[model samples]
Target: MDIELLRDYCLAKPAVEECFPFGPDNLVFKVNGKMFLLASIDQQPLQFNVKCDPEKAIELREQYPSILPGYHMNKKLWNTVIIDGSLSTQQLKEFIDHSYELVIKGKKK
Candidate 1:
């Protein structure tokens, strides 16, 4: 998914907000002040990082080459998904949902 699509998806989540806390190149999506997704605006083919369960993270990386260890993030708990048409739009939305849910769940701890 592209930046705008990703932005809309994230903002649709409850109490979600978008900001460039790291810099202009990175678009960060946070829920209740905790980050769940980070998209690089300066990259081609587009890519974004999403929080994921450790085991599921590895499983995704193994299942899809477009999905890899998170860039500049804790690899065990995050993933970098390349928007290269290999994954459907629905799948991308699921990734965003999972990330948002994970962040919200973590907030309770």
Candidate 2:
């Protein structure tokens, strides 16, 4: 998937907004002012970082080479996913949805 598609998908969620809070190189998507996903705009091969359950994070890293510990993020709770054509679009969207849901769930508590 491309950055536009990824941006659109994230923006489609309720209360979601995009910003460059970490400078122009990083595009961050947030819900209720809390970040759920982040993309490095200046990078190649389209990749993004998303929040994930600690256990599931490890599980995914083991199952998919494109999925790695979040670069420069909390390794236990985040994942850096590469859109290298190794995974389907549906799977990528699922990652975004999971992160979005997790942020919303946290806001409720």
Candidate 3:
């Protein structure tokens, strides 16, 4: 999906807010004041980093070349997903949901 679609998807989730705290190039999505997703607005091929279960993150990286260790993030807990048509929109949305859920879960702790 494109940036607008991704933005809409994340905003559709409960209590999600988009911000440019890291600067205009980096768009961040937060839930309950915790960041769960970060995308570079100026980047080509459209990529976003999402929080993920550590083991699952490895699995996804192994499964898809487009999924890699999060850029400038804790690689063990996040995955940078490239939106290059390799993944379906549903799959991307699921990733966003997982990221949001992970943030919410973290906030509870």
Instruction: Give the best candidate by lDDT.
Output: 2
Residue pairs with backbone atoms closer than 3 Å in model 1 (clashes): none
Report, for every candidate in turn, its global Cα lDDT versus the true structure: 0.94, 0.96, 0.94
The number of the candidate with the highest TM-score is 2
What lDDT is obtained when candidate 3 is compared to the true structure?
Answer: 0.94
- Give each prediction's root-mean-square deviation over alpha carbons: 0.6, 0.5, 0.7
Tens-digit lDDT track for model 1 on 1-109? 7888888888988898899999999999999999999999889989999999999999999999999999999999999999999999999999989999999999999
Task: Report the poorest 10 consecutive residues by lDDT, candidate 1.
Answer: 1-10
**Pairs in steric clash, model 2:** none
Per-residue lDDT tens digits for candidate 2, residues 1-109, read 9999999999999999999999999999999999999999878899999999999999999999999999999999999999999999999999999999999999999
TM-score of model number 1? 0.97
Error of 2 at 76 (Å): 0.3
Look at candidate 2 and tell me the lDDT of residue 32. Answer: 99
